[model samples]
Target: METTDLSTLPVPLHPGLPMLGNTLAFLRNPLGTLHTLQRQHERLVHLRIGGRHQYLVLRPEDVKHVIQENHRNYGRSPAFEILKIFLGNGLLTSDGDFWRRQRRLAQPAFHRQRLAALTTTMIAETANWIVELKQQRSKQPVNMSQAFMDVTMRIVCKTLFGSDTTGKLDGLSAALDDLNYLANKKMLSPLRFPYSWPTPDNVRSKRARTQVDTFIYGVIEQRRQRDEDKDDLLGMLLSAEDEDTGEKMSDQQLRDECVTIFSAGHETTAVSMAWTIYLLSQHPDVLMRLQAESRTVLGDAVTPSPDLFRSLTYTLQVVQESLRLYPPAWIMSRRAHNPDSIGPYTIPAGDTALISPYLLHRDPTNWPNPDRFDPDRFVPGGPKDQLHSYAYLPFGGGPRLCIGNQFALMEMQILLAMLVRSFELKATPNQRIIPKPLITLRPNQSIWIGLS
Candidate 1:
């Protein structure tokens, strides 16, 4: 691997007000500003976010170097601190020894073998939703985004915590929505308009966090009081012991892990399903292919198991392409733990490092016709692995990559195959596909789709 001098880095500062470091400007037009910067400077550019300079890594090689090779030099940024209120020290936010231990314990839960049992659950959830939607087709254009979110939420909740509690989930969903919106505002707002200063959003966020905490704590207590082996991740976590130290996770620790899994597992997969249907609605030929694959791979069966789901290569490829174009975790950041040179710039300790898969996936130099929804780009002999390591970071990379990647993929594949085979998705005329930047990138409005 080659390293470049820090002096040679293209550190172009976008114009901004005196005290704020282009926070408002970036918020207003993040993708546009990044695109403009890419046009004038090298792929790697400097962004003065807040008062500190953060490297906006756009080049594929630079992304790989930071996220994969030198991952230890970086950990998640303080911006993620907002998530701590509910997520606790789960795999998504934990660092150092805590992260390592939790990762080790939780890794098996997402294993191909362990996840195999959950395939029936995933397929059944999808089938139930699809059938319900098919019956209601004449009512009005269905919001596929919300519908999928509901389905994924049910699946994850049932699989993680057993039977569903609609009231608890309703409260949790509302609280999460409030927390995510306010957290984003806090990240982008200047001190003059500090988010903590009695703003409506801040107040709502506090309340929401409380709701989430209450629901999670309730679940934790129920599991502990029962004290019986349930054969779920929570049970395994409770049963797991360290070889050196005989220990189990504290109640708080259990609560955190459960909330983290609930939040992380549901939103991302739901967004992916929504976008896949949106894209499929646009490309009839590809939809036809997906439908054919679904029928061949899984006949009229509603609950095709996870093993059968993973074997559907074409269906998986379509989902992969949708992820490439509209990755739910659109922007990821890391704070430098050690001073390191990335590409032509030296990042000092405590500095933020950014990676936008949205930009990387659309870089024309690496992906030809990058903006086009071409599922064939992911087909066999399409240079999937041959590309730069970081060029395709839909689920992130390196050791800290998403623990549930395999689980999520299996669920999505099964759900998608079941969907396309049963009915065709027709996009509502004049419906807009606005990108709503939540804790994830979601379709802003109801994604209206007619199922036949």
Candidate 2:
């Protein structure tokens, strides 16, 4: 690939309707639009969104350049600015030194060993869900989407706040749903009005944000009153000190981190697990193999420990493949702070760069039969092993990679193992499964599965 002087040559542009640019097309079908661009432009594609210049980077090397190798030249995109209203400059939305500091402080909470110890909590919560699911098996079709959200939310609450406050947090799933809907709406709108306006969507978003803030703040107050440190994430955050300044996080900072973790931790895992189950339900052979692996490794054990869960290799592969097809964080955007050179194109400063795992994972050149659901691609020495490191980034890459990647993986493994062994999941007939690319890739319609 020959390098191109962007100053002299014009980059390939994806033409769109006047004024609206690609905004309407993008809103109508985000994943499809990106896929089309990737196929047409091959490497770098420029898009004009409401007069704003956006670059869609499709190649792995380009993705690596922006996210890892040359990450310093890039920062979180303005697209994520809308999320600051809810995330409040937390790890997800914060950039520069503050992000680094927060990442370091919160890293200990999600360490592998700490996550290993949380296996029991995962099993216990999953067991409770199994019981509830069993009771409702004979009722109307199960909304596995909402059900997984409930399970993952409970697990996150327990793991983050400890078991004492787990059940105390209700309406979290609904509140988060509202937030996701509002955030995505604002992100895709060509003419986004200030959030301060009294629009109906803004009103709903504020109410939803207030509900979440009220609950999290209440938790912080209760923990503060205790005057004792516990072993949970909240406890760690309360006692965590900045390595440089030796200062602790304030109430608002703590609240922000908690809310960020609360939203990111649960929403992604739930969607991933829900989509994984849905995929398994569609592929009976894969489901059979997964069940066999579960039974063989678990051997009638009611609950799975970390070691036993690790032995379910095929189950983990299914999770990986599901994420490839339906990555929770489907699209990521970054802003170039300085002029940067990718393989053959120069990205000018101030240009927005968009990277989508949804498109990258499905690229025909990197993945053969990309749309097929095949867990074997993730096995040792499998096809995915041959691909570039950045080519398979469901959790993203570089310095800002998802902090809870390990935690999310372990939680999904435990839930899938327990649920698959305990019940038979079948998708409701006549329901079309559409991946809605919002903050996370979710089912556009309700995913109804009959649990037998």
Candidate 3:
């Protein structure tokens, strides 16, 4: 039951243009706008966005309040309905007992030991990308964003579905383009025909959805009938049975989980890797340290193994710093199920409160010289060790911390080590590139890179 009480909304609403509120400014510069408003008022600032109530919570303690300490009173905001367009009722979008059960069933596949075994698969796919990049054999700039997206999508497909999506990449790419466009547009504009209506946008989304469904469902059906090796995440999901009732996931549930894993596992990792490499291009000193560490750890080896991953501390730090500066999962919105108090502020029930990793990670109070790209902040007992736990959650926090967090970090480490050790990468000179904040933070323009 959502509380409609307005008494708890004590903060003054941030000013915006008439009728539209701050939506236009937000559309132009989301990060700066929110941070500026919060600074002008209290740490918790209210704003009317798309005709809805949203309180921007900037305090680390307030973040701890919303996502950790008093989490039960909060739930996935209505904003998640957009994600469900692709993810369905999987762990990313589901709530309560359903999400709990899905998490339990899907948890075993992501165990450290199980994921360690997939390191080989991750390296192989990355090596394949290297081959593809080399075959192009040109020093001219290529779109590194799309390149990372392709390689990461291939890696996730192989590890999660037990096969590489090389052949289906073109089709999958086109389908995702359509879906992403619709989802982004709807999120920004907020007025569109019901998905069921025969609007042109709805039809395009449906067609794309069907194309992806065919591929995922076909893979699931084929695997179900075949008696060959079942050693991947999909296999685990299929075989997993609830301890309470011994019930296995239905085909529908499997499809939903597979899509969830694919979307979550693929695009976010792609964006992280792209940003990591691009940031390295700009910071040669940091890149030099990373290259030194990569060469030392990966001497005479074309690919890194799980054993060497621990020794590449600087490489890991570079990745960590990249996430802090340009976190792919930058902001998340949660709705209150009941009236709640966040630090000194009150959150009325049913109102949306946004806890942004981007905001918290950039707060000077939480991080000294917050905007600077300083990997040492993450160093052991070096600044990060002193901040509150919720102050730096690139993968979120609390019970809903991303299950694939380790998986993504390990994947990025292997690829970064391989790339730096093997090739010299230069960001295309003289082009403006920025982070475009969407469901994930992505390069606003095509980030071009050259390889020697």
Top lDDT prediction, candidate number: 2
- For residue 129, what is the lDDT in candidate 3? 84
* lDDT scores in order: 0.77, 0.85, 0.83
lDDT for model 2 = 0.85
lDDT of 3 by residue, 1-452 (tens): 88665545586678899998988888889988867875686578888887878898877877887888888888998878887886688988988789889889889988999888888898888887887888885858877888888888888888988776689978986787677778877777657667789988888889999998999899988898894467788888888889899998999999989887878788888888888888888888888888888888778766656688789888888888999998888889989998887655687888999888988888877788887988888787788888888888899988898999999999988888888887787877787777788888888877778887
Models, CA RMSD each: 3.0, 2.2, 3.2
lDDT string for model 1 (302-393, tens) is: 66655666568899899899999888888888999987776556777888888888888888878888889888888887866568878888
Candidate 2 per-residue C-alpha lDDT over 1-452 given as tens digits, one digit per residue, 9 for 90 to 100? 99855554446788899887888888777888887887788788889875678888888988998899989889988877889986788889999988888888888878888787777888888988898898878857899888988898889898888845545556766887789888878877767888889999989999999988888888889889988687778888888888888988889889889888888888888888889988988999999999988878877666656688888889899999999999988888899998777765677889988899999999999999999999999998989999999999999999989998888888898899898888877877888898987788988876888888
- Best of the two (1, 2) by TM-score: 2
Better of 1 and 2 by lDDT: 2
Worst 10 residues of 2 by lDDT: 4-13
TM-scores, one per candidate: 0.92, 0.95, 0.95
